[model samples]
Target: MTELDEPASAGPAVQLALRELGILLDKRVWAPGSRLPGERALAGQLGVSRSSLRQALAMLESEGRVHASAQRGWYVTTSVVSEPPSILKSFTDNARERGLVPTGRVLHRRVRPAAYEESRRLRIAPAAEVLEIARVRGLDTVPVCFETTVLVRARAAGLESVDLTDRSLFATLEEVAGVRVLRSAYSAHADAADAEAARLLGIPVGSPVLVGEEITSDQEDTPVLLCRSVYRGDAYRFEATLHRSPD
Candidate 1:
């Protein structure tokens, strides 16, 4: 009689190493944000060759179990998906929705004249006054994004006096100035963190990041805010639901 067929699998040696690596990850031997050991050391510890170890790591990365940072090394990517809100909301609100305690550190804030690029994006005249603010936003101790925003000063009056570190920008705007954000149009790109971005995010220089440039508008579609931000790539994933209409 023919025997029952067994499931096809990876080569025995590679499978053994993959199993061991999976065990380490499942046991939480490495905490999130902690960098993994070098390939040589990890391979030696796991009784595998460097190539085999790399194969296993690649598999983990595809599964969202690990992340490789540029010029640095591999780290455990946070399981949390970093998709933004469907409706207009502030960073504080976004973090809370993901079960994180949000915090912001104001880096700079001042009145600045809009440059040509800023003016075009915000639909304002060149050299118009604007309130510029830069901040580093985080969840607990993990710094995620460095954001800079430019607001039309005439629409954001008294904003300089707001305690930004503890307040929600959206809430403050609506409450203080009676201005509401209707929506934002933005684009995202893959990028490497520069020196300043790396310092603020606590990552090595040249680490991967997602740069977002956005223009926010009010109920009447008048542009009110211009924002540029770099989010840590390892800690966030962007997802969207898409549909195609009948052809």
Candidate 2:
């Protein structure tokens, strides 16, 4: 029988199809998170029976190389970007370490009076002027995080006028304001995407997301910035090394 007529149980046929699909993915014929063609089309294109194609797809799913969506067909899983909890690194630095291009789009920027909570977080008096900056952060043009940062205006003077698009905020702070981020206290939790977050991250509303909050301090241990970030759950991973306590 021809390859297209091979049964699903034919191991060779499924393996061949799996290899072909892997090559396509490596070449990025379809970008991360993009839906593949229908099973029938994919089967025909790969010169395999529908059953064999399904078997190959199942293998890929098991490997976390792709995922099936209810009613939406199979999608290429996004390349996961990971950061260790003990390391404090900028998004740009993390992406570059993984050979991905980091990008950002400034969504909003202004000087505003600090709210009560913001004042407390920054250890500044209430109503103190604060510079607020919001951005959509991405890897290779794929949106991954939405972030907002607030800092006392005096700590980062002239920062509001800096062009942040496709740039690192941490780097800019050091360069322009000479305000180095020496340390940060951070926390994260699971969340669902809201409408604005969905639009910015290019995901459906109610999709899984990771919400993170951080307060960063400078050399003197003075809080300099408070930030909140929402990350696409599918595209990001947080990792930490653990040790057993002494008995």
Candidate 3:
């Protein structure tokens, strides 16, 4: 059957359950190895019959979305795509959109003279003051990444006192600094997690991780923030849509 015709064949309850499961995975509400709610509870929550729920879960399991543990119940196998390429969103926004809670813990925040690299990236005078923050970011109760972000001090006015534990840097910048992130130039690569990153993410030292770096710009194309993030490879998935060039 064609892709479009497949959904029509699924019973309404199965279809709804599939959709809900997709959202939960997408938002990282259930991290890898997380146990799903019991069958009766889950069926009640989804307003579906036990048989329908089992069928829907079977489909997902076949697709690697979840797995059943003998007698222990179902669990998510991995994290789904957290962000879509066409839209730029903050970590908090991405999580919330997918039915998960986003949280951050500031490990360190300081205003110091910009280093050579920071100055170069932000296109500011050397030795200029800059605000740098290091944070451990998570979805629900799962530790997923650790990030270090830098911003030119002048562009981050009033940000020194903003509470970041339950907020996003992108949101705070827009609200307090009136800067909008129009776009970002980013790159990512696979790497082994270092001691600190491993500790923060509750992974073993030298575990595989995705390392990403980005330079974000405002609506006017002015560089605003520089960020380096390390994500736990097993608990996160990256997704992007590809478009063919027009002839």
RMSD of candidates 1 onward, in order: 6.2, 2.2, 8.8
Candidate number with greatest TM-score: 2
**In candidate 2, which residue ranges exceed 4 Å CA deviation?**
1-6, 243-247
Could you tell me which 10 consecutive residues in candidate 2 have the lowest summed lDDT? 2-11
Backbone clashes in each candidate structure, one number apiece?
A: 0, 0, 0
Q: Across residues 79-196, which tens digit of lDDT does each residue of candidate 1 receive?
A: 3536654555677777888887787899999998999998998888999999999999877657888999999999888798988895678788888888899888877899998999
TM-score of 3: 0.70
The TM-score that candidate 2 achieves is 0.91
115-140: candidate 3 lDDT, tens digit per residue: 99889989999999999999998877
lDDT of 2 by residue, 1-247 (tens): 8755666798877887899999999999998877899998998898888889899999999999998877778888886777766888899999998898999999999998999999998999999999999999998988999999998899998798989999988899999989889898988899999999999998889888999899999888989999999998888888776789999
Q: List the candidate 3 regions with Cα displacement exceeding 4 Å.
A: 1-78
User: Local error of candidate 3 at 153, Å?
Assistant: 0.9
